[model samples]
Target: MRGNTLSYGTRYLGRIQGIALLVGGAMLVGGCARLRPTADGELLGDDAVVAHARLLQMADTRAMDTLLVRQALAASTPSVRAAAALAIGQVSGRTLNHLARSLLADGDSAVAANAAYSLGLLRDTASVPALTGALGGRQSVAVEAAWALGQIGAPSRAAIEDALSKAALPEPVLASLLLATAKLRPVPVAQLIPFLRHSNAEIRWSAAYPVSRTLAPAGVRAMLDAARDESAPVRALAARALGRSATGDSLAAEALGALDTLARDSSAHVRINAVRSLASYGSAATTAVVALTADRDANVRIATAQILGTVLPPQRSVWISAWNADTAFMYRRSLLVSAVRAGAMLPALSPASADGWASHADWRYRAAAAEAGGSARSSSALLENALPHVGDADGRVRLAAYTAFATYADSSRFAWRNQILVPALNDPDFYVRATVLQALGSRASAAETPGILASYQRALADSLNDARIAAVRYLAAAWKRDSTNFPDSVRAMVQALKPSDDPLVRAEALESSIFSSWIAAPPGRRRLDWYQRKVRSVLLPALAGRPLSATIQTERGAMTVELFSIDAPLTVDNFASLARAGYYRNVQFHRVVPNFVAQDGDPRGDGNGGPGYAIRDELNRRRYGRGAVGMALSGPDTGGSQYFITHSPQPHLDGGYTVFGRILDGFEVLDALVQGDRILQVRIR
Candidate 1:
């Protein structure tokens, strides 16, 4: 962990060193404890102890934990009560809502904070008064209460406005209040302006968020002032807001000056966002683009490359030359691929240049080249060159090749699949096999049926859950495309949804069966119901109260995160189960977007790999701040193993990705992580 993180831990009781000991002690004492209350009426009974122990176990089966949750809620121990309050949200029982509401005034601060957080998840509007009351208190409780009010939405607007009207609140509390209030549909931007000019940078930045979104003409001065603020984060926020303003061109001169200044800011985060904002101004940012390309930060250079590709077409050679001259191909390969893909200059580039990269000594470059081939700008020659890498020795390169070829191999295009994709169906890597199957799914033709069916059958028999999922999806798509040609495919898909131990595989099978059909027949509906029943029965029990902690053993060092089982149980369960199954072992941190995130957990050691099935999104009010751990989904509910830890607070991703956990220790370890760093293992505690 970073030194500052270590010092921060010393002050933050939540990150206390003996957390494991505390948990273990709670469990041990409860094992033999009997039902008895002290004369003081503060002692926990055996039932309460047992309930607390069960809740602490982090059970995956949330729906079945209502009784235990109720018992723990009444427990005398503040920790037990806090844990229960959090659990109430996961269980999602109306009966527990009043209990959570009552805990909003719990004597202990932690219990109160958790209660507010849970009530938000429950969206209990009735708790508005209590939440608002808590907002005038300490930072921890206030942040949670304010966030809860936001989740309560329109109903809590008046209460939030009233809280903001009060004077001299702590910066953390006020900032959170502003953030929470901005999330409400009708943000009180007029009331927020004074705080925008507040001496405190945090409050200023928080005030800027809603103003930027609204882009009210009155807020322009505040935005401009914030752009020149001493704080890098505040400057970053202002710079971002300037780019989003409707009157961007009118404010171009001042905004550009701020952007240029912020682009060279001391903080890498400020510089990154400044460049991204510059890109948003279109060609108007051409002058800034040239300076950004030569930026000291590698990520800035990468983002600059992506921007110049679209806005400065004349810089094509400059971009290509930079790529060729950069000696650190291994480190720069992923960024280069992203840059190339964003630049859309592949078609204009020489086939020889693409070939050289495709055949590079580094597998990452080859993999990247394969990915680049999928882009619309890529030439047929590039695609052809990428095909050879499909059978390349590296599994990651092969996966990328399959992905690229799949993108290029549309149903209208026939020759490439037979030449490259067909052979990949039998590839040793299950992901490669799955990708190939996925590619063939959309091809509409009677001629492709037999081979596709054979491949589908092979995939269904494969041991990997992802492979089975791919097969079921392909079957559904194929059945939809040509019922006459693949008459049994739909029926086969429905049959695959039968009682299964694997929730991921069954979930995918059900989705493909129900949604893939062009017309949902009565039979399909019945099948969907059957599949739903099977899934709920098989998954929920295993999911209940499963305690989850992940020991992310990175190359730098090991860090443990106590997954937030109550708030985001599904995400926690997915991560914990995968860790226990050794899925994340040896996976590399594939993408490290500086000052943004350090992402890993793809088995392919590339961003594209997953367990092949997506779970429901458990989006919550949790902020994506530094050390926050979240599932890295491409879209809603797409998370599966691939997760990221934030380097700094990322407000933009707050409601987008599911924040399931936080780094309990090892901030330095997460800070030190970079692309290509291997996760030695992710031990589930």
Candidate 2:
């Protein structure tokens, strides 16, 4: 809601001043009013109206709406033309892109603004010239164009620099340009130095982050100046920014002094930020954060407890003592996460007991004890002790205990998860059943196919997405079982998957589809070209023209992804081509090791699925961060269509895998790939 967002509204026909007349004219029936020509001679009609409305949704047939929208741009009314500009940019196709670029050259100022907005989604360098030209034009168009440059990212670097030189652009838009530029690596650090003095709080705040990250000298000076600003929020923000800066002890000392002064400020919101910011300071900031743990506000105290666990985490003996003493379940949970992150509390976590928390009559305390016991899943003794809770009286605590067992379960070490987890596949709750499906899958590494098969049979009959997804996960891991009714079961789920609400379901379904596609392809041809077709016809083309409100659909669900094609064209192109070729159809997910990746696209139905070719690894700093769509490779540059969606940020893969795409939806589905899910089919719209 920053930058030029406000300008998009409040212009043209809509304003508060017109509200009174509209209220008085509420009975009037101009709702279906005729198109009235402005100074232009063109007339907008029903087709134009429909084309204009297309802007509201980014979807499968957006390409079909593109040409009609281009003509709508020629409409006489500013609103219709503006809507057309918006709709034109909402699609992703070469033809639609051409039309969207043309709108940037439109005669109307509003049309130019819409064109700039569309170009942001296009992410095409070719549109930079037109967008930059719009920025130098009259009124709000400049602000919109600045925003478009930020959306398009690196391609608009020069244009962004040129806009910065102009004093005409608003402070917020200029601030946005600086933030976006910082992410580009080779940013204009020298130029951004001036924004520190701007009257706008947002501009200063945005500038503060990149400067601290870049460790720019001018930025350090600017933050210091901001720390002394008359506004407490700005002072607090500046102080917090310095705490995490590379400025080291010098900055920490300065920030600590500022924080102490602001801790006494009247604003609870500022104090909350201060509590979190203490993470940037090691020992020096601990006292301040801990002091706030007893603050009058409940939320503040909660935040303080959370921060204390992070900043000055407890020792193992102290952690055990706190658990033995503290009555607040939430506080103890925070302490566990804190102690775990601090890396010294696992010994205390070992040897959990069954009725351990029944010592207290409170059901919540019992549940908390069970839940906490599950957190020690890495230790078999703890997981073993917590296993009985999978059938506990409280559905939620039972589900949590199961997840913990599955999360840390190792197949080679013991057959305990096999004995306890497989039977829980039919657990009543959607979550418990899902965990059981995965825990059973993990036991398959121990080669218990019979147990795996039984779990899949029970879960396949369940309708919860996690159950359906788990069946697919298990089937992929056990290809021998997948060759039977499994494929049909997987496809049924795809056909039944609700794609709009969840992202994990879609990724799993799509990944499962990749497995299915590999399975269905004619032998020997299941290589790079197969993936190319899918990316072109389905994936890339979906986001080619405009920024879609809801652009891509997968077997699991639908999502809106901001395409990074401008930065990773080959990677994006590969995804789109694979989607178009049905490369994801009927393919086994191929790889589903816990806490690693829910992978697919191997025709061999092993970890060997590929497009029969390789792509040079194009790893920037972004790497295989969690939920990233990355190209899986055999060696340095052996990447193809074989890819993985990691569950957590993996900086280890940064220089290895080529990160080309990311999940905009359906993360839960990837998490649900409980060792046996099979994809029915994969489609992109």
Candidate 3:
């Protein structure tokens, strides 16, 4: 019945393309060899390709028409069946699990692989037996089944271990099985130790990844062995696992020694992870970490500065020297904050010295000064000095000032805290307003404060979706704090939002936990019309055989990424369109975590800006290996213009984010990127 209700867009395109191709084929076949149709009566050439594309569009839009997907699953063409199987997973078509499960035994490896991947996405526990059985069938199929079993969580751990125990498995399949084992709770760490020494470096890193997450004391010795691994990636993960398992015992001393050696390793990646791991040893690691303050790599220096701040005593002169020596904004900011945290009396926090940084030409320094003010022992003076920055010309500085005041300032002792804060709710920047709402909501006293409650109430009607979501969060916090004293007007306002036109707002309301009845009700299905229109107008045109590589020109250097147009057509189209429109020009990489990811694409220069809308995730089988480009999200289906590039293999991010592309070159540029690095332009080929 659902298939019978196919949108006009699907039918119109099929008729036009199919007829034109049929006419063309007749002319060609008359002059050459006759073409044939497939066993299912579907044409075997261009027509089938068009049909496959149509199924992908349905998947992209998250169309709720399951009957069409079902029909495609049974199509004679392997490509069409593969597309349909993937679509069922993308759309979360739980009802179509049976059809997808049947495809696990499909003759085509691609079809069976996609079917296993779909079952994983659906988390179909019922299909675990079928998925496990497919583990010995084909290389591609077995890997997907292992990953799917892992995605299914605890139910599949035993099967995963059983498969891992088998001898002579393909390296790729063994790697997938090892990574999948990480997803299970109370990981079988002992079983993974031998793989830490696997001849293939890829398998070794894969084993080390799970060990890093759930490192028990038993794995510490093996990890120490891995810490000396020839591969930097394996060593880096081993360093992390050692840190996690570190205790005040003999093994911890051995780990500390290995970490110390790794701290000076030639690789910056190894040094960064090793330095962070050393921090767990407290005073024992301070000396080794302190020596790396002059490390050649900025990221290493930043890591070293951070550890020293946490481990060093108050009177250590290295804090002041490091803060003064580094001219880099992020490094200097790290040292300054760390100095304050260690209870060191830095001249920078002094009233006269604070003015120098607060009035610095660079807004980054000014923001840093505001952040340092928050970390100081006596926050009142620093808070007072930062009060004027609440109205700074730059939104970042203003955001910092307000965040510091809300988080660090003693509201009871400081009379002007709320006076400066209450006015910011009306700030021009939506991010600032959203931040203020979250700050207000987190306070225990917000429920009794008429002004704060009124602020949440007023924000419910704010123009921005983010602000409204924050207001809903505030209401949820208030209700949880004490519902009997909750305001009825706020309750009514939340109720009104339950049926909001904005999907994000409605989703937020459902997430707020205030409406139990609304939570129990199944979500309504979205129509395929909008998605079909987007497919016809935007997605299809973008995929017209042009190269999909995008070169991101930054001050550091240009990083070329090959977009995964076939797998993530809509997301690629959205990014390419934005790049062409100059949307990402001059955007700064607002967030960067060492050895993790460098995130950018915020026109607002904060992490929150988008292209005024959201797009559904096109999650595929792409693993988040080093240089993998992925769409960042606030929640599901919230991807927009913002994206991030991984610095190393991130198994955790594999299925979560939309991996639309990957860097083909300029890896050094990716490693060198810091928080304030700017994207000069993105040139799409």
Candidate 4:
């Protein structure tokens, strides 16, 4: 991940010679006084300086050019000679091939090591001696030698065999070799088996994933044995390996038993891994996972609950009735998590079980239930168990409760959920407050977004960009929910009225407003269906009638956007009319979900605010989300002037409502409008 090459100017000037020995070789250590700059005497320097500069210029293509080889081999400085050798190997020809072989004798390890890399890159068979020598010289020397040898293919077979034969190869080196070999050959499993008990944790851990992909009967048993090891990391890795392994009659009991022990492992991480792995076992390990859904650790319980949420049949009860029979205090929290994941309302646990979790003082369990049980529909019974517990002393639990509400807020079926969000706005945790804004962003109507909007407006200036970015996502979601163009127009009006400090914010404003709108109102399943959607156009005094300048920037150039008033007559007329009025000006492009498009256009400089009014559903065929420029809406066809661009396919918004036009070029620039990046301004060309 680190930069792979040194900058050329520094690399060239940094290598000055310091002293000359009687043997004609120069010792270049900078501290040597004998070679220090002199005031009076001229050393043999002019010719050498000219030659060095010439060599520096020649270095780029010297490997392919044969004329430089003899001079490069005879160069006074090892560095220059090394540079030339490196280039020599880069080219394909007979004469330069000999020069690459000659570089093995170079004294400088840096030069020789590079030459080894070049040899490997060249895959020249004769460089075997050089690579083998590099293996013993230094670890980097050896490691690169090994990598290159492997890259060299079978040319260095004897050296590779000899290196493998040595029992003393250090674990890191072996690990590197194993990692490298795993890339090259299927024998990585066989080669790594002997090193399983090796003293390196990294080697064992890295080996686990690859081994899981290539399981042998013996390897499976070894991994199973490792699952019971005292080391939690080892146990976790072994569990993952086993989960991916194919189970036959011989391994079935062992596999299930390992999962059982792992689900109950004292380590939280191991338990979480077990929850995921157990799910991979499907129904074979369902009973164990069910028991695990009751694990004492909140993480394990949550993971079990969440995994079962998806893996369990949709609408089929994920919760079983038998979990209520568990009388143990610890068992209740975990069991209820399982029950809730099964889509059942809160299970009828014994009152004693709830009191024990509430009384034990850990407090997170109570919070965990509120957070994890978010999937479980709230009822009078659930509220009886959950509402009083929200008053728990632990601040963490209270925070979880607030965050969980956001997950629940969007469900119309859970209309009573806002009872949770309104109160949580003031919670101490910024995390909880953030989550509330997000939920409200999705579920909040324009009226409902007022409080969250003010909060986001204040927080956007805070140093943390994540809060701002999140606020943008929610605000975008909120605006889309309120389908009227006016909610979005209010945003454009503010931007049009704003002071231009970051012209960048203007780009974001345009992007966010446009993106959220597209997400809100995608094209109808049939293009004609989108035409049926309607919104009342408020005629702006400035816009008697003019074309909208709908160009989005990409790296190559900008693409023009045209709203179709004839096709989606109402949406087109309204947005084009707004564009003609100079409604969009210095707005911030507030939301840019990476690999997704940039969003802008909340008047508050937050993403939540949208024009007031909801429209009917206009389902269309155009896909929404990435690079899409479509109308924003409330519910179905409640489209407004606010529109958006998408960077990827958002099937979720398809067949929702009107899509007018897409960016024809400039997608690269659209990709560049990153979070915290400003929109310069969106104007007619």
Candidate 5:
């Protein structure tokens, strides 16, 4: 999922102020202001500038030096203090929470906001009292503190309620607080109901988001009213809330009627959410759901296909008809996977048809055929359908076949299971090998098979980093299953890789090794001199005055995006450098979820590949709105070449992902993209 470590390089900077800029016939609204320089009129000296850059570099490298952070926090300059507060949060250990909390009352709003954000990042439960007290402070600080409380989750609910009970909160603060409520479990639906009717569209939409997340029956009436709100986002979330809350309740019929109307709403985003909600009514909503399968929007059709099996019976004629009629591979694949998930007999595909698909020239169809085996009625049928393709010429097909076998087949009943699986350890594809290793490790028979053991032994020396990581996981799983019988060689291998050059491999090895006590230790700082130099020489200079923009050329059209270089310089530099090096050329948008995101930058065409190295996340104050570009990560600090652009406002993703850019033009082009769409090239400006 991650990549190997490499020596660092320097980059440059740019900043955006809250202003509207006309770019190529489109209006681009930059919501965030540029990071302020020192208050003094005197230009920052060279040493001072480098020192400031070093603080950011320390955060980038996750250097956990409390003393340095404390010194920076005590700086007279608001910018330095603000940077230190952000760094403390980015480093993300609880060691500096006290010092960070002390900055909550700083004279500068930016300093206080950054401190609250850091406290939230640390997830320090002890800071709740202090954070809650700031909920009524400056509007900006209150918003950040509320978000931080939400990040801390349910423990801060009473404090949030206490603030809400107060006389009058500003619209911005109230809207932020309402959105934060979405993150807490057992959402305060009663408190949220009144806000749904708020005159301000922003507040109404914010209230709708929490109700959508909780789906509490009590909010059904208010949500129903919100469904007709002028704002598409409010209507979209309200539709979801109605479907989830109205199920098996007195409001079911009324809710169903509202969903049907909303399903035809002008906004594709509203329609996508409405279609998903319609699934809750079962057969009662089938006709409406089936009608959407023919919708002109590919994403809407994809959404309809996804839930068709849930709404319609397994024997419905519509499944086969849709599969045959839909020409798009993504839609057809969605239909098959949905049908299989619902345990459909899949009578649509006869033996000859199945065989034809398996032999199809396109590997995607072949992979789908392999995946369809999960729908088989019996073990024999499952094995008969999936086992033959384990050695398919296409690695994706082989990967799909192994995945099906792993999920459905009773490998223990088949005497030749090891024969089929052991050889896959040598599969040229690292992902396939990793999947096979996972499959083998999961089976009880792996411990008794000499070939399987030998395969694990050989995988330790594999060239690919992911395969070696998988081998370490297999060793850990094997050890856990039968520690008494665990081989010394495997244990030794795990120990030997603990200091691996690859950060992921080392992290994995450290996690798997017998030295469990050492796992709690903080991660060692990787302050590579080359990386620091690059941050100072390349990244810092690039951010001077001018803003950076990237034009991504896809078959649909070209979309120009303005980079948030000042807020997320590291991420922007990585993307720009990668673009210049041709890493994204010809790469497919491997993942596209309706009304959510279109993700790309994976070389393997699967969602798993990266640029062969990982980059540190530069999480900033940027919010995810329509056309926002953010990094994709499997977990914290694992971001690499992959990134995605939001199709609509996704409030839940705020503060969770590194958002580095926003679309400046070609919104229509973004809306037109679908799965497997190719990036023709990326031009940096």
Candidate 6:
């Protein structure tokens, strides 16, 4: 079932501050005063700046540092004071909530903004009153306070409704409030509906955000009217609203007609959203998809391809024609990959042609070919094409080939699990090795237990903790499928448990040792002792340090991020160490989901590439707000090179994924990032 739903990339759902511009005088809002460093003689002014810088550099906070942060918060300079407020929030978490609340009304706007944003991170619900008042401050502080209110959710609902009902508010403040209101449950639709016809496009979109979420009849009618609004953004918002309210009955005939008209709108964004909404209609909207597949916008064509892959079976020819006609490289690549993911074929391309395309100079083409090789319908002539690519120079292509071999291989004719997949269990890339282990578990039969056991043995000795974890799973599945007398499986699991530095590996092995009846010798209690000691020595220390900062340089611009060193130290170290080694240099963002996330850090330009190891998750109370940077996990601790930045808040990911970092600067860059955008390098400062 997992492989059947082919995700082009892992969507690790776990599922910030405008710090850089305000602190550095980078010109954010017009006429806003700049924050400056305090004079040397001012009490703790110079010391505060130095301490703040050091605080930012630390991967985890020490108790002694809290005194220094508190002292800095009293500094004369607003910038130093602002930095200290942020540092205090980062170090103390919710312990210093009262002090941060007091700073919300600080004389300096920068200080107020920092305090507001930090409260959002701390999830200080009781401070909603103070935060709402700050929304009447300067534009910068108001925006930050608005975001904090949204983070507080249900607690701020009463205060926000009261504010909106009062005297007419400024557009900036109103827009932010509407945006924040959309994030809360039990949305105030009665109040929000009036804004549907707001003169400003932003307010209209903000209104649509919650309106689309509720999908009430009135909201749907409002959005239908909005679809015909003169502004492109309003139309785009209407399309998204329609898409979210995709229930068969909710998508009325009038609404569908409006969306079909918008699908041909002049704006590519509107068209993209319109086509995306049309996907939820299935075969009923086949005519719209057929026409949009040849639209001028490449993104529209790409979205149409995705719809065709899942919705209509007969559109296989149309999908292939669009793929062939697409001039945009990323669009073409998405079409082919998505087709394979949906188990659909490009009817126009022959197996010989697919083989030739697989060998094309571009790695994207090869990755597509590898995924296609797994499709029985597409691989009739190209079945053997992906076989040799198991050792392809590019890790992305090699990974795709392995998936193809495991998923679509002729079990009777080929011993892929033993010959190709088993051997690749020792692959240099951690992602490749892990994927091979999963493939073996899913595809290997009872007769192949011996070969799988041999591969599991190799995996336990692997340098990366990810490979070792995979070995435990592979052995468990193999044992479940075919019961054998090989005591080595238990021995190997025990060996992985003791003296292992990775806590995740130890945990897995301990679970197998205690619950599994397979292990014949060595009592489970004794094994637990060894595992507990290994955890105490290895994992605890890494988690106790302060957070660190990294500067990611993309082709567009540079953005600074504060890695959650204390909460997810192992994950932070893995990313920082990889960045230090130039692991992310010149890597392409292989996947970009509009209004969701932009994912990158794969050297092979495919979503599956990773460093030679994996790190265990360090999930915490951190919510996935816009600009939240977290590791991309396949399932459980599968996080590696891939990371994503959320374009909007994602509540569904809460308690489900790891939140490791938050973007401190240049968040605008994330909105502009598209598939194939390159990361020039990542510097762990």
TM-scores, all candidates, are 0.73, 0.57, 0.85, 0.38, 0.87, 0.66
- In order, candidate lDDTs are 0.63, 0.51, 0.72, 0.49, 0.71, 0.63
lDDT of 2 by residue, 180-272 (tens): 565455557677767767788667655654554566555656666766666654565554456565456556666667666555556554565
Instruction: Rank by lDDT, highest first.
Output: 3, 5, 1, 6, 2, 4
Tens-digit per-residue lDDT, 137-182, candidate 5: 9988888898889888888889887776775888888877888887
Predicted candidate 1 versus true structure: per-residue lDDT over 308-375, tens digit per residue: 54455534565565555434444345335545555435422345664567667877777777776665
User: Which tens-of-lDDT digit does each residue in 600-653 have in candidate 3?
Assistant: 877666565666566667778888899999887765676777788888888777
> On a 0 to 1 TM-score scale, where does candidate 3 land against the true structure?
0.85
Model 2 alpha-carbon drift over 4 Å, by segment: 1-64, 75-80, 212-221, 243-245, 311-388, 406-424, 435-464, 470-685
lDDT of 1 at 298: 61
Candidate 3 residue pairs in clash (backbone atoms < 3 Å): none
For model 4, give the 10-residue run with minimal summed lDDT: 12-21
| Top candidate when judged by TM-score against the true structure | 5
Model 4 misplacement above 4 A: 1-137, 140-170, 177-205, 213-236, 244-251, 257-336, 339-369, 375-398, 408-429, 440-452, 458-469, 476-489, 492-685
Candidate 2 lDDT at 530 equals 40
Clashes of 6: 11
Q: Output the worst ten-in-a-row residue range by lDDT, candidate 3.
A: 13-22
Tell me, what's the RMSD of every candidate?
Answer: 9.1, 16.4, 8.7, 24.2, 8.0, 10.4
Better of 1 and 4 by TM-score: 1
The residue ranges of model 5 lying beyond 4 angstroms of the native Cα positions read 1-42, 76-78, 244-246, 315-317, 341-355, 375-381, 409-422, 443-464, 487-499, 513-529, 536-543
Give the alpha carbon lDDT tens digit for every residue of 282-344 in model 4.
677767877765566544554565466434543424454434434443344545565565555
Candidates 1 and 4: which is better by lDDT?
1
Question: Model 5, clash count?
Answer: 9
With candidate 5 superimposed using the best TM-score fit, by how many Å does residue 122's alpha carbon deviate from the native? 0.9
Error of 4 at 660 (Å): 52
Which candidate, 2 or 6, would have the higher TM-score against the true structure? 6
